[model samples]
Target: MILVTGATGNIGRSLVGRLAGAGAEVRALTRSAGRATVPAGVGVVEGDLDDPGSLRPALTGVEAIFLLRTGDTDTSQILKTAAEAGIARVVTVSSLLAQTHPDSSVGRTLLRGEQVVRDSGLEWTILRPWEFFSNLLFWAPAIRSDGVVRAPRPGLPSPAIDPRDIASVAASALLEDGHGGKTYPLTGPATLTPQEKIAAISAALGRPLRFEEDPSLATEDPADDLAAAVSFPGVCAVASPGALSTVEDVTGVPATAFRQWAIEHADSFR
Candidate 1:
């Protein structure tokens, strides 16, 4: 049986569907059972990675796991429990910044979790995805109100990837063979600036959208600055282009372009 943590999340939900459709005996761990609506045959269990005892029952008869880096609790004990339960493999959704960045708290947390998983003696595949294309949803409210997209950073280009591609890679690594000990850096085909992303959204929505630059990060508002610090990892001046081949190589499919994702999700902006 395969286990998926954070089952209701963007990537985990899609991955659960994919694995269940492929006829795998899928088990999903969620804190609340009230909101988890998975397939009919898939198992839904209440478990938290922070609390390993809660996961012990769910880990029974499980062979593989999809781990989410919650950053709230240390995962070494949970991973050790999985190893003791005879779980063979683990596929973790980590961040690209986990490797190149040690300053950010999120990056450091993920790096520590990755270390735990690696040293747990389980066959592991780590996915270090760049900023997601779905992050454009942050502009939905502004677009719906005034057809404007605002960002605090200026002149930053990021190769944001679609979540579906990440799910695809996860599914492949989980069910198929020959994916152990690999860290894939997933990104989109094109590196687009914030202005370019706004343009893409404008074209997709059939409207003229204006880009608003907020360089100061709104120092007066602590909430706004904190949100910016967490979400804008790859949108700085010195950010580099992320690797794009890992998606195609692992899933045998191309990563969805930012424009394509924009077109598909354009209705959300309206």
Candidate 2:
């Protein structure tokens, strides 16, 4: 049996379905499975990462686990519980910032989680992915009301990846072989600026929209949350030489483009 934490989240939601569709015996571990909607023929277990004791029921009979990092997660304890439960493999969804800026606190937290997973004495695969394209959902209200997207960082093009691709790669690592001890950094096919993404949404919606950059809204506070998320300095994997694959090189599937993702999720903006 395979266990998945954060099963109700964006990537976990997709990962659960993908694993079930691939005919794997899957168990989804969520704190509130009463409200979670998982695929058929899959087991739903109520568990919380905050409480390691809650994970025992879900870890039982599970050979592999896919973990999603959360603010309240105790990485070492969680890995220890899984290892003691006889779970042999782990696939952790990490951040690109973990690699780009390993010295930052947020970076250190993520790096420490990766280190714990690697040292757990189990076969492990680390998936470091850039920001998720789904984060653009934050612009849904503005686009729906006035067909406009407001943001800062106009010149910084971010490689926003589809959450489904990350799940797909994770499934590959869990169900297939040779991915142990490997760390794959995933990204979207194209690096797009905020304005370019706005244009793509406009075209996908068959209407006109505009991007409004608000430099005044930009904060230089070192403790700012955005600074921890996407404020990495001197790191541009998209512009770097021989950038890593969109995760397709290893998963044998193409990464979804932002425009295509927009088209599929166009109704959200409406």
Candidate 3:
């Protein structure tokens, strides 16, 4: 059986379904059983990653796990519990900022997660995905209320990826072999600026939308300026090209283009 933490979350929720669709016995871990609505046949159990002792029941008969950063608490004890519970593998969704902003608090948190999973002696795959296409949903309010999106660095281009693709890769790593000890930096097919993303959403919604450059929207942290997975270093790195990678190389499937993602999730903005 495979255990999925953060089962009610965006990626984890989808991952549970995908794994069940792939015929894996999936056990979803969440703090609230009533809130976790996974595919039929998935075992939804109440558990929190921060509370390592609560995971014993969830880890029973489980061989693999998909861990997510849930709290500010340390995850080493939970990983240790997984190892003791006979887990053989773990696939974690970390961040690209773990490399670009290693000194930052968020970056350190991701690094610690990788370290715990790696030291647990289980076969592990770490997915350090860049900013997700779903992040554009943050503008849904503005798009609905004003038909205008406000963001900082409108000219900045990001090789943002589709979360569905990220979930797919995680599913593959959990069920398949040979992904252990590998870190996949997942990104979209093209480098697009915020303006381009706005334009894609506009096309998907079949309406005109405007992009407003708002420097005040930038975070004071400087590193978290993008307000996504990117960092201050990423602010500069994404400005240039060649950072984009073929998602097929990692997941054996083509990356989802922003336009396609916009089309698929257009209703969210509506």
Candidate 4:
């Protein structure tokens, strides 16, 4: 059976669905099974990554795992438990910041998690995805209320990716062989700035939206350092290697574009 952690999350939700659709025996691990909505025939079990002991029930009979790292979890202990439970393979979702901004606290934490997964003695694949298109949902409220997106660095660009594509690749790595010890950096097909993204949303909604450069909107909280780093612009733009075709190469499907994602999710902004 394949175990999916953070099953209610963006990527995990899609991964579980994809696995189930492929007729794989899948189990979704969430902190609250009662609340999670997964596909039919997929098992739902309550487990917490922070408390590895709680994962016993979820890990039973599982052969492979899609592990999603949470803030400050005991990754080593978690992997040790999975290994002891007879899980032979693991696919982890990490961030591109671990490669581009290693000096930052968030990057360091992600890198440490990846290293632990690598040393866990299980066949492992690491996915380092760039900024997610879902991050634009942060502006949904503003757009719905005033048809305006107020943020900093309106012109800074990033080759942001779709969370579903990340899930697709993760599913392939989990169920398919020949992916062990591989680390894939995933990105969308285009690099778009905040202004361009707003334009796409505008077109999707068939309305006019404005982009305001408000530097004050940039977050200063240390707790949200990763969000601030990716949302504000300069940090990622300097390090992005441009758009990559890894998504298509791995899943045999082209990476999603920002405009297309906007059209699909336009209702959120409406």
Tens digits of per-residue lDDT, candidate 1, 1-270, equal 999998998899989999999999999899997889999899899987788878999999999999987857667888888998999999998888776565666567777878888898999999998877877787788889999666666646677888888988999999999999998888887788888888999999998998877766544344443345445433434464554688888888888887888898989999
Give per-residue lDDT, candidate 2, residue 57: 83
Order of models, best TM-score first: 4, 2, 1, 3
Per-residue lDDT tens digits for candidate 4, residues 1-270, read 999999999999999999999999999999888999988899999988999999988999999999998888899999999999999999999988888778888788888889999999999999999988988888888899999777654445689999999999999999899999999999999987777888899999999998887767756663565566565542333447689999999999999988999999999999
For candidate 3, lDDT tens digit of each residue in 65-114? 99886666557888889999999999988878787677867778778878
Error of 4 at 109 (Å): 2.2
Which of the predicted structures, 2 or 4, would earn the higher lDDT when compared with the native?
4
Candidate 1, poorest ten consecutive residues by summed lDDT? 218-227
lDDT of each: 0.82, 0.82, 0.80, 0.88
Worst 10 residues of 3 by lDDT: 231-240
Q: Write the per-residue lDDT of candidate 2 for residues 133-218, one digit (tens) a residue.
A: 88888888888999867654454567778899999999999999999999998888877777788888898899999987665755
The clash tally of candidate 3 reads 0
The collision pairs in model 3 are none
TM-score of each: 0.90, 0.92, 0.90, 0.94
Residue 207 of model 3 has an lDDT of 96
RMSD of 4: 2.5
Cα-based lDDT at residue 45, candidate 2: 93
